[model samples]
Target: ELAPRGYIAEGWLNAVRTREDAYPTGLAMPAANIAIPHTDPGFVAKPYIAVVKPAAPVTFNAMAGMGAPVPAQIVINLGIAEPGGQVEALQALMNIFMDTDAAADVLGQTTPQGMVDAIRRHF
Candidate 1:
């Protein structure tokens, strides 16, 4: 089944599971930070893309220990919008995080725009 807007169901579920993988792409929301890393539905070879977000700073083991969280000022919503665009989106995001200095700056920014600007530089 699908939504009136063409939102696929299977892909959504898979996205949730794929997001669960921490080592590859895991984050823990800091005490005053919040962030959501989600992907498109199409990224999913089976269902959805590998996307996940943490409600609170989750202590992910496989990834490391404490993954980053969402920006407290931003509303981090999760879901697969498209059918096959997740892979690229996620890859792009991963590439951005590859920079240790950049990721540090992004996760430590004080304001929302600062955070966004940090992300914009990635793409």
Candidate 2:
């Protein structure tokens, strides 16, 4: 649905899933464990970030050394067409990931709009 909505290429979702299955994007942060799933620029139609908070955490391999399995509560689907922007976005997200207080605050939001607003304020 997100891909067909013009946020990414037709096969972007499959690409992301495949990439994640192979490389894993999970990060074990001080605040909370998270996974930043993304695909190459060729699979992107426009730059967008989808914030998904599942009712239950999903296990993913950690991005760090040894690739430990981590249960992530927050999954950010990064849809960036430009490499430069992807780097910048990841850097910003890393900051939020490390901030337990900020991450908790963002997760406390009860609505989608509130989550977006929280992200904007934090970033």
Judging by TM-score against the true structure, name the best candidate. Answer: 2
Which candidate tops lDDT? 2
- The count of residue-pair clashes in candidate 1 stands at 17
- Tens-digit lDDT track for model 1 on 20-76? 554333333322233344545453333322222333454333224444432232223
Residue 120 lDDT (model 1)? 71
* Candidate 2 Cα misplacement greater than 4 A, ranges: 64-67
Model 2 lDDT tens row, 4-53: 58887778778988888887888888898888989888898887888988
TM-scores for all candidates? 0.45, 0.91
